[model samples]
Target: MEYQESFINYLRYEKRTSPHTVVAYKKDLDQFVCFITEMVGEFDVNKVDSKLVRTWIVSLMEKQLSPRSVNRKVSTVKAFFRFLMKEKIVETNPAVNLPLPKVRKKLPGFVEEESLHHLLDDGFFPGDFRGVRDKLIVALLYATGIRLAELMQLKGSSFDTKNYLIKVLGKRQKERIIPYPREMNNLLFEYLEIRNREIGYFPDILLVTEKGKPVYEKLIYRVVKKSLEYVTSFEQKSPHVIRHSYATHLLNKGADLNAVKELLGHSSLAATQIYTHTTFEKLHDIYKQAHPRG
Candidate 1:
């Protein structure tokens, strides 16, 4: 447990991982520790071996965990062992060179552009403070393709109003500037006016509740879900769907893939390539419809 705590601190303080990621790492480590203690009658980092890690993976598979989930657990174990090796608490890494389960790729889900247009432009959102804020939430997500975490961390200072650009702090504390549509400026100004006039107090943070308190994760989810319910019937109507919609819409309109990757703040183009699959599917449908042979 001491070694685990030290590694967790290393992730939090030195690596500066997000709180959500740190919590996930801690849970994965705890599960691994429990498995080790049960299998060997004791928990000693030095005594762990590749065979034991394989056995743990087998046990996770037996529990009917999905391949992607099992792979994530394997990655967690591998990372933990690497951390131990770096700290000199363990002389060897136990989980190195371990094989992960194969996962079938699923194309990201996205709402159609027409549906989003109806949602945003068809009087779906009311004309009040909360309504305008909710509209902005959906608009900014589609316009800028920012993640939920990035949206939550946005402040007034993060915006370059003159340039129609927003600075987003993405994964690993990397920052990128994304340009929003010019139409979003009106919604932003209106939300600010109502927020200040009604709440009567302004914080550094941009989005706040009716009570002027900082919004939370669940609240953001609820806001997105509730508003999307009026427009999309897709089972997954979370903020990420809006992000996917943003990327898909951009690609369908012939936006450059590399430009999209940079706008999304992706570490590699591969992470941004999934949206191309969605675009390809759209082209396939068009080809099927317009082909002379058909």
Candidate 2:
């Protein structure tokens, strides 16, 4: 367990995995370690073997975990064993030969373009400071397709109005400059004019609470939810829903796959490829409506 904690730290610093992901990976491996600890009545990474790994996996199956969940747990095991092997702590890697379960790909759910228009129209009127700020948040998300965490760290000075670009800190501390449209840029400026009007202290973040605090995750969530609630009739509404909408809408608009991928800050084109399904579905509908084949 001591060494396991050390390995988690290594994941944090060396691998640069998010704290959330590191915690999940640790939980998975700890569960495995507990199983082996109970079976052998001792803790020794060297004592692990393929049999115990198989047994634990079977137990997970009995517990009714989805194939995707099982596969992720197995991946955790593989990473842990590989880490142990690298340190010469284990004679052989038990998880090296372990197999992953296959899972069907489910397309991401996103808001329709009409729904997005409705949502934007529903925001409070005539330049309410918070309204302007929240609307800009929505516009920026759609325009740039950056993640919530990346958006949170954005600073007042990060926006380059001349180029209509924003410098955001992304996963693994990597920084990327994402350009937005004139509309989003103009909305951002309108929000900026009201930035310091609040009573209490304010953080240097681009978006903030009315009391001048840096915008927390919950505030962002509520902004997205409230805005979407008024504008659209969608059953599911969230920040991520808009993110999916952003990608799907872009692909539908004939934006290049790799270009959208970069805009979304995706590490792999494979991840960006999923939006093709949404674009294809739209194309299918257009063909059905326009083609007079009957």
Candidate 3:
């Protein structure tokens, strides 16, 4: 337990991991510790071996967890053991050489451009403050490719209106700037006018409730879901779907991959490449429809 606490501190302070990630790691480690204690009458990190790790993996699978989720748990264990090895608390890494289950990558779902255009262009939003705020939320998410947390933390000062770029604080507190369209600038100016009248500028956050408080996750999700339902029949309609649509649309329009990666505040090109699968699917359809051989 002492070693586990040290490892968590290392992740939190030294690694600068996000709070959400630290909580997940701690949860996974606690579960592993509990499993080991139940099996051996007491938890002992040194007693852990590959066989014991395999037993726990089997137990997790029997609980009907998805392979992807199980794999993540196993990775957490591996990271902990690696930390233990580095600290000289354990000489052998029991989590090492554990085979992970293969996970199928599902292409991210996105709203079609025409559907989004229909929703935005056809006056689906109302003229009220709530309507304008909700509409701009959807537009900003799709336009900037910023994550929900980033949007939540957004401040009014983050916008460089004359430069037409907004600054985003991404995972691990990394900051990046993304430029928006000229028309989006106009929408933002209008939203600000409504925001000033409704909320009275007390919060100073870029996005606020009509009551002058910062927006919470559930409210954001509800806003995005309700707005998306009018035009998209996609099974999943969350803020992330809007973000996925943002990346996919950019790639479909011939935006460079690296440029999109930077714009989306991704740490690696690999993380940003997932959207290319959707773009390729579009190209395949167009080829089939336009080729003379068909």
Candidate 4:
């Protein structure tokens, strides 16, 4: 367990992993330690073997944990063991070459373009500061496809209003510039005016609470979920779903794949390619309706 703390510190300070990621890794390691302790009456770094590790995997599967979750936990153990090897605390990494469960990929869910347009264009949002801010939040996520973390870090300084661009700090602190529609300029200006009048010019943070504090994750989720309820009956309505809609809609409009990859701030094209499946499904539906050969 001492080594677990050290490994976590390594992830935090050395690898510069995100706080969210560090917390998840810590939780997985803690769960693994509990399993080992209950099984052998004690957890010894040297005493752990592949069989014991495999047994833990079996236990997780028996509990009906999804393959993706099991794979993530397995990766946690494997990384911890590799760290132990580097520190010379162990000779052989018991988790080395351990087989991972196969994960079934699911298509990303997105709202139809028409529903989103109706929601934004129909004046569903109220005219007050809170309503304007909430509308901009929904619009920004759908328009730019930035993640929740990136949205939280946005500032008035992050925008290039003249050029209709937003600078986003994405995963791993990587920075990318994304452009929004010129039409959104009016909405942005309106939100800023109301925000300044009500919240007193907190230029350092673009979005804020009614109490003048920067908005947090739950607030953002609530704004997105509530706004989405009017436009979509989808069981899942969150910022990322808007993000998925952003990417899928772009691809459906014939945007270049590599260009979309950059817009979404994906490190590789493979991640951006998933939206193509959604696009293909749309084309298939259109084909079924339009093509009638007698």
User: Top model by TM-score, which number?
Assistant: 1
- Look at candidate 4 and tell me the lDDT of residue 67: 98
Candidate 2 minimal-lDDT segment of 10 residues: 196-205
Best candidate per lDDT, number?
Answer: 4
lDDT of 1 by residue, 14-89 (tens): 8888888899989998999999999999999889999999999999999999998898888888889888888778
Candidate 3 per-residue lDDT, tens place, 1-294, comes to 898899999999998887778999999999999999999898888888899999999999999999989998999999998998898888988887877778999889999988887877789999888988888888889879889988888887888989889998888779898998778888888988888877677445888887888999999999999998999889999989988999999999999999999998888999899999999999999999999984
Q: Rank the candidates by lDDT, best first.
A: 4, 1, 3, 2
Pairwise lDDT winner, candidates 1 and 4: 4
- Model 1: which ten-residue window has the lowest total lDDT? 195-204
* Candidate 4: regions farther than 4 A off: none
Report how far off residue 280 is in candidate 1 (Å): 0.8
Name the lDDT value of residue 212 in candidate 4: 94
Residue 289 of model 4 has an lDDT of 88
RMSD of each: 1.2, 2.4, 1.7, 1.7
Alpha-carbon TM-score of each model against the true structure: 0.97, 0.89, 0.94, 0.94
Error of 4 at 283 (Å): 1.1
Q: Rate the local accuracy (lDDT) of all candidates.
A: 0.90, 0.81, 0.89, 0.93
Candidate 4 pairs with clashing backbones: none
Per-residue error (Å), model 2, residue 102: 2.5
